[model samples]
Target: MATSISPLEVADCEVLHAIEQQAHSHPWSLPTIQSCFGGLYHNIGLYEANEIVGFAIVQQVIDEATLMDICVSPACQGKGYGKQLLKQVLEQAQHRGVKIMMLEVRASNQAAIALYLKLGFTETYRREGYYPTESGREDAIMMELTLT
Candidate 1:
């Protein structure tokens, strides 16, 4: 069992891309993923059996951190991998001295919202017309966690 987390390398782009594509209906572009590890943010990959299983991207601005993206491979979803990944990411952020963690999820993504709440995040506000939806725009529910 190769369950471990490592700082994502440029070489891990393909795996992250694959996981993103598989997990999101509106997947992020390759350039966006590359930009995450391009010196502006911190990115981590969850590896198992020498392969990537999930990833989290976080951008730090002073004491605040924005969890830009987090996703588990479609095949790995519902197996507690997402939970583990989220906990690890939060721990890492706290260890880095980040005081707050925030992220936005589509209002319809009940699973993600539930997980965030279970992890101590509270709803902050809603961003109307924030994300692209099949029909017009979808509201984004903002969630925040205070590490300290």
Candidate 2:
């Protein structure tokens, strides 16, 4: 029974950071995560009952939405939390009149790449050496989804 919580809550940071460290080998720093407040950033958490299960961080500029980060606790992966988080973002987009959704992912992350593709996102470009990896660097696959 995952639940959703406000990312702006101070206490929620610890839970978010914990899940982030558990989910990403190179997770975004707590400060970097905080910097997402766009003065209007839309970051959401997935919870069950009262436990934080996953999260999605995103921002918008006019009619476009750029997904900055996302993660689901390893223990809860494959439980639809990721999809739910993404759906929330899309709903936010629709509410804000966003026409396109965009994001970049490490080329090596086949599972996430497949998920994005399955969600109707199309590869539009790639940014080489966009992420640091055990193998040095990885390309960032740019993907976009049209809202209407």
Candidate 3:
């Protein structure tokens, strides 16, 4: 299937929120997602047949960028859409002259860690009990990819 990446618009908020709620155990609130617009944030959507299948939100400051949130629709998982979304975000960051990219993932998210590693990200630090979980809290693994 052919997929295209484009800047996320206000009209996409509801669809992206629905995807996020379906894709993650703890999804960002609609207001939080909406706040990604304007500012120094870049929000991109992966469209398949004019519908958003995946999305990413990145915040950039000077030469650095942070991958704040990324998700693929529940029905679209395991089909490389997440990777494509991340790739697009990386390309956008590089195009904007971002020198480094960083993100934090739940320590239990081995799949995401593996993907990041495969895409040239390195583990930089760990935050103990940074994420709330069903069983108390979970650690957060911090990773970074140097674009320069």
Candidate 4:
């Protein structure tokens, strides 16, 4: 199916939240997802036939942006939707004058790490035991992409 990227609307939160829950073992609360709708946050949704299949949330500060959260519905995973959403986020950040984009992924998320690396992001740091896991906690790998 052809997918298009667009700004996430308030009405889209419920579906996005549902997708998030299915996409992650520890999903953001609905309130947390709703909070990204305003302020310095940029939320974009990947729509297939007007239904959200993936989304990315980013926050900008000065010349830098943080990719706060990104996910593609489990049913829609591995079909390049994640990459497309990420590219849209990067383009939007660059258009907003952001010079760098940063994100943290669970150290065990090799798929995500590979994708980030494929998109020119380099490992910048690591936060030990930064994310909760079934076995207690997991490290977070911080990655950065210089856009300017």
What would the per-residue lDDT of candidate 2 be over residues 17-110, giving only the tens digit for each residue? 8888999979888887767765456788887777878888778888888998888999999877788788888887788898999999999889
Question: For candidate 3, which ten residues in a row score worst on lDDT?
Answer: 1-10
Off by over 4 Å in 4: none
Clashing pairs in 1: none
Whole-model Cα lDDT of every candidate shown, in order: 0.89, 0.83, 0.92, 0.93
lDDT of 4 by residue, 37-74 (tens): 77788999999888889999998999999999999999
Off by over 4 Å in 2: 2-11
Tens digit of per-residue lDDT, candidate 3, span 18-116: 999998888899999999888798999999898899999999999999999999998988989989889889988999999999999999998899999
Name the better of 2 and 3 by lDDT.
3
Instruction: Indicate the TM-score of model 2.
Output: 0.91
- How many angstroms is residue 85 displaced in model 1 relative to the true structure, after the best TM-score fit? 0.9
lDDT of 1 by residue, 74-132 (tens): 88888777788889889989898999999999998999999999999999999998999
Best-to-worst order by TM-score is 4, 3, 1, 2
**TM-score: the better of candidates 2 and 3:** 3
RMSD (CA, Å), each prediction: 1.2, 1.7, 0.9, 0.8
